[model samples]
Target: MHELTTVTDSAAAQLQQVRDLVALLDDAQYVRRPPGASSVAGHVRHCVDHYAALLAGAERGTVDYDRRERGGALETDRTLALARLDVVRSRVRALAPGVLDRPVEVSGIVDARGTVARSRSTVGRELLFVAHHAVHHLALMMPVVRTLGVSVPADLGYAPATMAFLRQRDGGTPA
Candidate 1:
């Protein structure tokens, strides 16, 4: 339960940071594209899409990362994105501890031939994966945010282990 809570809280915090950053951007900043780079809106949409997929999988026994709603209003409307973030955060917080260890089927591409592979996983593991996925996308968003002159927290996109290591190196106790 503790581990589940930690992961949920971490995810919630990451989403909150995203919400904060997005709140500072106008529509142009949110949707602006640099050459060969994804827009800030696109990154936010991708992260939220994964959370939606993970939550859907938690309800069913199968998880498919490839099944996603791409380029919806979530990628353009900040209010819509924040609303979805709230819903995902709430759903994550409401996950039952008993369901954390339940077996689940995870499907994804595994080979150069684009063959879909299926494997067994647990809800807890998938939650951790989603959290990490959010962090990964957030890291990618950092440069976009900076280019837009938006400042976010230093730990906004760091993993738990990375944050702890950074804290220790800075002569602070590990978070």
Candidate 2:
């Protein structure tokens, strides 16, 4: 929390959070399904895909969120998931501060009817978004982990803004 001053820093922290969460699970638990809920691997893969897309977009100047790695090993293989998480963390941390402000185009489907929406953004903005988006999926996975008998750390998967507010309210991250 002390070092998350830049968008890239925040993105790295989010990926680290994913690493922390994944470290708690075995391969079985990573892909284990809780009745009526998505597997932890599924959620993790979804988040990872967005992060990957964000990085890819930064290079291409266009980010397509819908271009996901669905059914990839990231969803079922713990080692592969861990490797990608590490790569993403390293990549985000390596982003130049100037890259944050660079303009980029973005597109994604907005509805089940397959309508695509387009917009403009900066690499920093999209990084922040995917980080926050990962936290959202993390929140959903928390209960799944619990149901699977894993102990979740208190601060894992919390949104950055919420953590900031928590620091102000309690003078530190929530216990």
Candidate 3:
């Protein structure tokens, strides 16, 4: 098992990257859903929904990722999206240290047919999942941002494990 603090810290860093990305974009860019791509605000809202589900479920011992607030201001309004970004980050960081060890029942839509998969997990594990979920969405958003002529962090979309490997292979430098 991994140390919960380490997992949370890395997750926080990932979210911070997202915050930085949003700060760099203009109002139009933030809400622009590029052709065949999701908008930056869309990704932020989706991530917040997962984080919200995790936070809500942590208290009850069951997390339903399928419970999402799809579309609306969160996906269109930059101000709302930015506020949610901060709130989710604060909520994530404020999670009780011991809560990570608590058991949680998890559920999510798994297929095109809308099948739901169920499983047992710990809050620490769910935190990792939700954070990585955001990172993957960030991956999709990065290319869209790039095509719009905006600069972004080189390591924006990489998984924590991949980032560690990159630093190691590159002699402690981000490459």
RMSD of each: 2.4, 2.4, 2.1
For each candidate, what TM-score against the reference? 0.90, 0.92, 0.91
108 Cα displacement, candidate 3 (Å)? 2.1
Full-model lDDT for every candidate: 0.82, 0.87, 0.85
State the TM-score for model 3: 0.91
lDDT per residue (tens digit) for residues 1-175 in model 3: 3479887876777788788888889889998878898888888888888988999999999999888789878877777777877888888888777989999999888999999999999999999998899889888888889988997767777777788897888856344
Q: Which scores better on TM-score, 2 or 3?
A: 2
lDDT of 3 at 162: 81
The model with the greater lDDT, 2 or 3, is 2
Segments of candidate 1 deviating more than 4 angstroms = 111-113, 172-175
lDDT winner among the candidates?
A: 2
Q: How close is candidate 1 to the true structure, as a TM-score?
A: 0.90
